[model samples]
Target chain A: MRIAVDCMGGDHGPSVTLPACQAFLTAHPDVELVLVGTADALAPAAAWPRCTLVTASEVVAMDDPVEVALRRKRDSSMRVAITQVKPDATGLTRADACVSAGNTGALMAVARYILKTFDGIDRPAIAAMLPNSTGGFTKVLDLGANVDCSAEHLLQFAIMGSALVAALDGKNAPTVGLLNIGEEDIKGSEVIKRAGELLRQAGAAGLINFQGNVEGNDIFKGTTDLVVCDGFVGNVALKTAEGLASMISGFIKAEFTRNAWTRIVALVALPVLNRFKGRVDYRRYGGATLLGLRGLVFKAHGSSDAFAFQNALQRAYDAARNRMLDQVRDRVVSALQAMPAAPDTARQAA
Target chain B: MRIAVDCMGGDHGPSVTLPACQAFLTAHPDVELVLVGTADALAPAAAWPRCTLVTASEVVAMDDPVEVALRRKRDSSMRVAITQVKPDATGLTRADACVSAGNTGALMAVARYILKTFDGIDRPAIAAMLPNSTGGFTKVLDLGANVDCSAEHLLQFAIMGSALVAALDGKNAPTVGLLNIGEEDIKGSEVIKRAGELLRQAGAAGLINFQGNVEGNDIFKGTTDLVVCDGFVGNVALKTAEGLASMISGFIKAEFTRNAWTRIVALVALPVLNRFKGRVDYRRYGGATLLGLRGLVFKAHGSSDAFAFQNALQRAYDAARNRMLDQVRDRVVSALQAMPAAPDTARQAA
Candidate 1:
């Protein structure tokens, strides 16, 4: 399997990605590693016989527009990385994946443009995997895909997220939920209200396990296997979740480090503390996947280090090996094809 | 000082309020507590001589409408307690403060109706005293009052929050920040953008200590004394914070109680943990006050226990004695009088 890694991505970049790639290669001797970026930009320590380098003169800064970067910056690392995955050129096995730890927008755009979307999917969504109290990962989609969304788009996301979770976690027809302000059916705005009805109809028909609305507070409660929402609210919820986790962890560390006695106590609690840390660690899940795409693309956090980068590459490899994209396509096609077309308003009223 | 405690509010109602009042009376020895609710409903609780019972026969449920409860439920505990604040037919202060552990909307309505808005203040925001790493409380306003907001309203909240922080923490000219998606000038929506400009003008002109825009992650950093935003975002942020605190604390307790070895570690960490718990304890700050009102009206959490209720009462008494409302009104009037009205074209441009 050939896994493409963007060497110019993330805060640590080559320093982190290089070591992660080397580590991954050492473990998976059969898997080939392709590092994309200018040789001058990469760390001296990264020069290895097993790792092949694809030179790209430029780098896409985190703030650059994804579409503009893809079109104008022909020699950019991100574009170069995606170019290698243009299914027609590589003859690379369908069992291959592309990973990037760069601007999420760039990664999403490149993936959508290069890999394309599935049969009935309007917009692709990113599903962030978070740990639940049940010791499993819950898939939350559209962390920040399209800022504005419609009911139909949300429904597509739900179906796609459910498929991803099923393919990844082996949870067939995983329970899907629409994230809203409240749990009641009549709780959200017009878009959510319509989406809730659609989900209910779909769930009743057994296409997906649509568990009603889940609120912000209930995200970590492990109530649903898959949660879907538009990018606006989803971004807010995701960032808020990240902020809260950091805040709590910071408070704990600060409190323990304040005095000598508390510091001692902190030391004593290390084993149990590590266990809890491992439970909430995002590194365990690696990176967020832009589902509904025709090819495998994984987006690692921009600030990720070597450990997280390696985990992201591994996740991408797993998705490729598991044929996640193909499975999603098949399931989505079946789901959409099974549904009846829009009925005439007059006839429906009658 | 006389504080009217809503004995028919909250889930526990009299069960929590009565004990809280009794405890406060025993501790203070001088403050008078007035219990507002049906005599039958409140009589079952253990009573204290310093507490006076004012019968309010009607009760408003948690899910009831704010305006309807305020108007139709005239004899409800919230309205009754708030009514005790006004000068009676005899023209004397019946109660110096009003306290309620009830539906937040109802409390806000009754408080606004009875106390009225302070001069130059359009809306009275709900201000929460949150725990900070500084071992003190940072005042946050508009926690969930108005979902849709404007720059002008956010400016008013900032002014009010600044004054409240000064009154509570003795931080004269407290720094106020506008919460946004990011810290950069171009990071937020139009509302936040306009608010940031206005606040910068206000700060530069010496009306407030406006600290510019702050991201969601910075709230717990204790960088600003007062954080202001629209009710919708603030409400979500507040709930998110509460949920996070509960989750972390629950996780800690669960881990510590898991086994005998962990139990020994818990014992070793008990002293430090208790201190940490005390620092983040919501009960200590009591209830949040409805700022920018003409008189003191505070709303305790609906699920608050006796300790929280008592702290709410104490907070109301302190605000009343300090004449916080009057101070806030004076400052707001001064600021408004001093601020130059933007030119007609500027208003249109805005």
Candidate 2:
């Protein structure tokens, strides 16, 4: 399997991605890496075995706008890497999947422009797994992909999310929960209420396993295999979790290093503290998949180190090997065909 | 200042509230307490100094629906306590403010029914202070009060939240941030975008210290003194934070108690760990204030213990003493007067 890597993306650029690529290639003997970056950035990977270097002239900055990445920088590394996944005139693709650790907005825009979404899907959604209390992870979708989603759009998210989870976790018919402020069916805004109805209908039709409504706390409680919400709410919840984790860890560090005596105690409890930190570390989760597109594309955190970026590469390889794109296409086709004849009327009635 | 206590509410009922009342009374000798509950529940508080016991026939269950609390349980302890803050025929209130640790929905419903909202404010909002890294609290509003809010409603929330911070924290010109998915002006849904425009207008008119747009992480970063959003988004963010905290603490405990060796280390590091826990404890932040109403009402967490309940009472006492209601009234009147004549048109343009 050939996977394209955006070597010049992320905050540290080559310093992080190069080492991650080396580690990933060592671990997977059957996988080949197509390193895309400027000549200076790709020089380190030139001698690597089973690696093909494809040089680009430009690099997308971490803070560059979508327009700059999409229109201005035609030969940017991120765009070049994504182009490797796009099929040519003969329907032959150079890489099975693509991975990038760059600006999220720019990456999404460039990916969508190069390899448009599937026929049944209107927009691609961002899906990521958050660690849950059951020693497992819960996959949440629409994480800032499309802020304003219709009921039909949410139903599509559920179907696509189910396929992605099934492909990655080998969990067929993963249970899906519609995220809301309350668990009751009557709660939330008009859009959420409508989405709940659509999800329940989809469940009845055996398109996806819909498990009624769930509150934000349920995301970490392992109440369902997947949680679906509008991108706006999902993004806020994700960022809020990130912020809280940072604050709690900061507080722990401050307390441990407050006094010389406390520092001694911290030294004694180093093993316990490291174990606790490992369990909640976001880097271990790897990357977020941009689902519903024609090809597989994973977005690593912009500030990812070598370890995190390697995990993203592994995630993309696993998804591609498991035929995630085929799974999504099949699910979307069947789900859309099974939808009601007058979905708009049904939403209005709801 | 006199504060009414609903002894029959919350998970522990009188067991928690009675002790909290006693502690509050001891802390403030000049403040009086009006204990409202069933006759049996108020028996312990009858002999307390500077306390008045008012008998109510019914009690609101923690799981009771809003309709039941608002209509069926007219004499519920939660209702009776809120009634103490309502004006009588002679325009004299029995208590300056009321505190309840009950079902949040029922508390808001009953409080709104008894006290009603101010003229310029369309709906009441739940405002609570979240601990920030700066060691100060960021006050967030519309936390599960109104699921759907208009641009004008968001403006009202900013005004009320500002007054609330000024009254409780003594920060006269606290900055207000409109919560959105992104910091950019063109980001987020239509409602959020319109709310941003209205907030900027309010800032220009000197009605509020609006700080443009802020993301969810800003709540903990202390980027602004106040964060305003629709109840749906705010509630999800708050609960998401709560869920994350629980998971992290649980992970820490599990790690410490995994085996004998870790347990020994935990024993030596007990003080540092305890200090870390205390820093993120939600109980220390006390209760959420029901803002934009004519009378003052605070809702503590339903599962609050005596310590948490005492903090809630202290918050209520402080707000009452500082004349929070008058401050909110003045701010709302001035803000509404400064608003554009065609708010709907302005929203359309946005």
Q: Which stretches of candidate 2 lie over 4 Å from their true place?
A: A340-350, B340-350
lDDT per residue as tens, model 1, A66-151: 55676877788887787666677545533377788998877787767777877777778888887665656678887767644667
* lDDT (10s digit) by residue, model 2, range A1-350: 99999998899999999999999999999999999999988997889999999999999998787789889999999999999999999988999999999888888888888999887777788999999988899999989878767887788889999998899889999999999888889888887888899899899989999999988898998899999988889999999889888888888999999999999998999989999999999999958999988888999999999999999999999999999999999998887788643233211000
Instruction: Give a tens-digit lDDT track for model 2, residues B190-233.
Output: 77888899889889888888889998899998999999988888
Q: What shift in Å separates residue A53 of candidate 1 from its native position after superposition?
A: 2.1
